[model samples]
Target: MKTTFVSLALFLAVVAQMVASMAVITNPVSSTKGKGGKKLSVVWNDDGKSPKISDWGGVNVFLAVGSQNVQYKLQQLGSNLPVTQTKGSWKVDPSIGANSKSYFIRMEGTKLGSDGNPPMAFSARFELSNMSGQFNSTVQNAANGKEGAAPSSSTTGSSGSSSTSSASSSSTSSTGLSGAASSSKSSSASSSSSTTSGVAPIYLNSALVTVGAIAAGVAAFV
Candidate 1:
C-alpha cells in the first residue's frame, strides 16, 4: 500500500509540471521596452525540455493591444520564423503609437506541444512611448502586413473602419430596396385582378340589357 501511494504522488507531480511549462519571454519584461524605428531583440526560452519550441516547424511574432485582450491588431513583426532560433529582431513603427502600460508581445508556434496545442508565449506589458523618429514606411509595411504580414486585411488598412462600416450599410440598403420593389409589384397585381374580374362583368350585363330593349321596340312596330 505504501509503494502504491508513492507512485501515484510522483505521477501527479510530473503531470502538474508539464502543464506549467510554456514558451518563456525573457525580454520586454517590465524592464525591457520598445523604441520606435530602433532594432530590438525578441527573445524566448529554450529550456531543452521535451518538445522544445526550437524544433517547431515555424513561428510568428506579433504585437497585441492589451496584455489580456486583442487590440489594433496591427500586423506580424516576423513571419515563418525558425523556432530553432529563440531570438529575432524587430523595430516598432513610429507612426503606430504605443505608450500605455497595456500593450503586449506574443510568439506563436505552428507545431503542437505536449499539451496537443501549438506553443505560444506572451510578454508582460511594455512601453513604446518615446519613438526614435518619424514614421518608417518600410518597417511599418512589414509589420502592418502591406508587404506580406496582412495580419488582417482590416488591420492592413486600419483607417476608417469606414470600409467595413460601408459594407454593412450597403447590405442594409439592398434589403430595403428589395422589399420596396416586391411591395410595388404586389400592389400592381391586385389592381389588375380587380379590373379584370369585377368591373368587366358589370359592363357586359349593361350591354345585353340595351340590346333586348331595342328588339322589343322593333317587334311592337311590326
Candidate 2:
C-alpha cells in the first residue's frame, strides 16, 4: 500500500523533470557576451520521457530575436544537431547588431508544431558587441534551413598570389629565340630571377649558311 504510493510519486517526479528539459538551452544564460570572430559553445539539453529525443531525430540551432509580439530569426548556427548530444560550436558574425541585447539562441526540434514548423525553444535574451568579451535579427521572408557559411581563409602565396589552402603550384615559361639563322649575336647571360622556374633557351652565333652553300656549289663543279 505505502510502497505503491511512493512509487507513483517518484514516477511523477521523473516525468516532470523530463518535461522541463524537452529542449532547454543551457549556455549564454542571459548574460553571455559574444563578439565578431569569437567562437561560442552552443549547448542545450533535452529528455523525452514519452516521445523521446530520438523520436524527433535532430534539432536545428538558430540565432534569433524576440519581442513581446513576435520572434525574428537571424542566422542558423547549425543544422541537424543531435537532440541528446546538444552541443555545437558557433562563431559570432560581425554583421550582426552592435552592442545588441535582444538576441537569443533557438533550438528547434524536427517535430512539427501547430504552425507547420518545427517546435522551437529559446534561451534567455543575450547581448552581442563589436568589442571583445561582450555578451553576444530580422524576420526572414522565408524560413531558410541553410546553415551559415564558414569564415573565408586566405594564405600568402608567391608573386602576389593568395591561396586559401596550402597547395603546391608551379609555372614554367620558355622564351625561345626564333630565326636562329638570322641572329647575329647571342648573350651568354641567363634570364633574370623569375617568379616561376623555367628552362632558358641557349643560342649560339649564327651559322654561315651562305658560305656553306658556296662551298657545296664549287665541289659540284670540280
Candidate 3:
C-alpha cells in the first residue's frame, strides 16, 4: 500500500509538471514597435527561423505601405527565404523606409512546372494598422478555419516596375485575440504534426511524460 501511494503521488506530480510545461510552450509573448511609434504586444509560438523550400518553388514575401514595397529575401529581416514550407510563428517586421499609417504584406508560393516554369500555387495577404494594434493575414486566419478573401496581384508605384500582391478579399477585420490567437493555435498544431525535425523537442517531451505516467501506473499495480 505504501508503494502504491508513492507511485500515485509520483504520477500526480509528473502530470502537474507536464501541464505546466504545455501551458508555457503554447503561450509566448513578444513585443515590437510599429513604424508609427506604437508598441504592439503579440502572443506567438517563437518557432525560430522561417522555412526554406526548393529553389524551384521559392517564395516571395513583401510588405507595402502606399507606394513603397519592401521585399524580404530569405534570411533578410530574419526570414529563412523559404517561408512557405514551415509551420510555426515566423517573426517579421513590416516596416520599410519611412513610417506609414498602414502596412500591407503578402506571400507568394510557386511550383515549378514540367515546362521549366514556375506558377503560383499559394498566396496570402495581410494588413496591419497602428490604430487597431492588430494584423490580419488571410492565410493565417484561414488555417484556423476562418473564411476570408483570396490574394490578388497589385503593382507598386514606388518600387520601380515591381508587382505587389494583396489579399483584400474579406470585408471583415479581426481584433487582436480573435485573429492572432487562432493563428497561433493552428500553427502550433500544424508544426507539431507536419515536420519531424521542427517539433522534435516538443514531441520528445510529451512522449517522456506519457511514458512516465504509464510506468507509474504499472508500478502501482505491481
Candidate 4:
C-alpha cells in the first residue's frame, strides 16, 4: 500500500511540474540599463532560418535613422541579377513601449536556361510585425522552447527584425531593478556583433526604423 501511495505522489508531482512549465508569464518586463552609460544595441539571427540571405540572388539590407534621413546599406554579394522593386513598404518604430516594430523583406533570382541563356523568375516580398507583449512573448516562448526545465521562449520563429534580448547592469534602483533602460541601438549593436563574426557593427542614431533589401526580382527601398 505504501509503494502504491508513493507512486501516485510521484505521478502527481510530474504532472504539476509539466503544468508549471507551460504557464505563460506576460508580466511587464522592467527594462534595465547597461553596465556603462552606452545605449542598448540590437542583433539579428538572420543566418539560421527562412529564405536565408545567401539563398537568394544579390541582396542588400539597409537601415534609415533620424530626421536627417541618413541611411546605411549592407552590401550584397552572390549571384548577379536585376534589381526589381516589390510592392508595399516595411516600417517599424522602436520608440514605442515593448514591441512596436515591423519588418520588410524582398527576394529576387534567376535561373540559367538550357539554351545557354538565363531565365528569370519574379521576386517575392514578405512583411510582418507584431505588438502586444503577451502575444509576442507567448509566441516567442513557444518557438524557443524550454532550455532546461523552464518553459519555452517564443512561438513565432520570426518576431520581426527589431526584437532583441537586453543586457542588464547589477546596480539596482528605487524600482528594485536596474537603472534606466539602455537605448535600443546599444542592444541592436550587441546582437549584430555577436551573431555576425568578422563583420562591422551598424549604429542606429535615431528613432526611425527602416530595413531595405534588394534581390533580382525583389527590392525594398527604406
Give the per-residue lDDT digits (tens) of candidate 1, residues 161-194: 0001111111111112100100011123323211
Supply candidate 3's per-residue lDDT for 18.
Answer: 30
TM-score of each: 0.46, 0.47, 0.23, 0.16
Give the per-residue lDDT digits (tens) of candidate 3, residues 27-50: 111112333333322221212211
Per-residue accuracy of model 4 over 113-163 as CA lDDT, tens digit each:
222212111111122223211112222231122111111111111111211
lDDT preference between candidates 1 and 2, better one: 2
- The global C-alpha lDDT for each of the candidates, from Candidate 1 onward, is 0.36, 0.36, 0.23, 0.20
User: Model 2 over residues 174-200: C-alpha lDDT tens digits?
Assistant: 122110001111222442222211211
Pairs of residues clashing in candidate 1 = 145-150
For lDDT, the strongest prediction is: 2
Ranked candidates (TM-score, high to low): 2, 1, 3, 4
TM-score of predicted structure 4? 0.16
| RMSD of candidates 1 onward, in order | 34.7, 34.2, 21.3, 22.0
> lDDT: which is higher, 1 or 3?
1
